[model samples]
Target: MAGQWVEVLGGIMEGSGQILRVSTALNCLLGLLLWVQKIRAGAARHA
Candidate 1:
């Protein structure tokens, strides 16, 4: 039982580390995409 607990916690820690990194990268990409769209919309409005 104790071994299972350790294994589960280790797995969660390892998985979450990668997920955090991926989510951070995805968030940045989405933010940049939104910013680009906003700029384009503003330019279109002006024109």
Candidate 2:
């Protein structure tokens, strides 16, 4: 199997400005997309 890697973007990482790459997995990424879809769907239902 190939190795998995997640790159941290941005040129600088200040004290509280660190963007950790934690959503690189398939399930983790899908969960985020689904969550966003749910939010949009709620707005559409109300509108």
Error of 1 at 12 (Å): 9.4
User: What ranges in model 2 sit over 4 Å off?
Assistant: 1-3, 12-16, 21-47
Clash pairs detected, candidate 2: none
Stretches of candidate 1 exceeding 4 Å from the true structure? 1-14, 32-47
lDDT, candidate 1, 1-47, per-residue tens: 11121111222323445544554555565432111112122222344
Candidate 2 lDDT (Cα, 0 to 1):
0.30
lDDT of 1: 0.33
- TM-score (all chains, Cα) for each model: 0.34, 0.17
Q: Which candidate is the best by TM-score?
A: 1
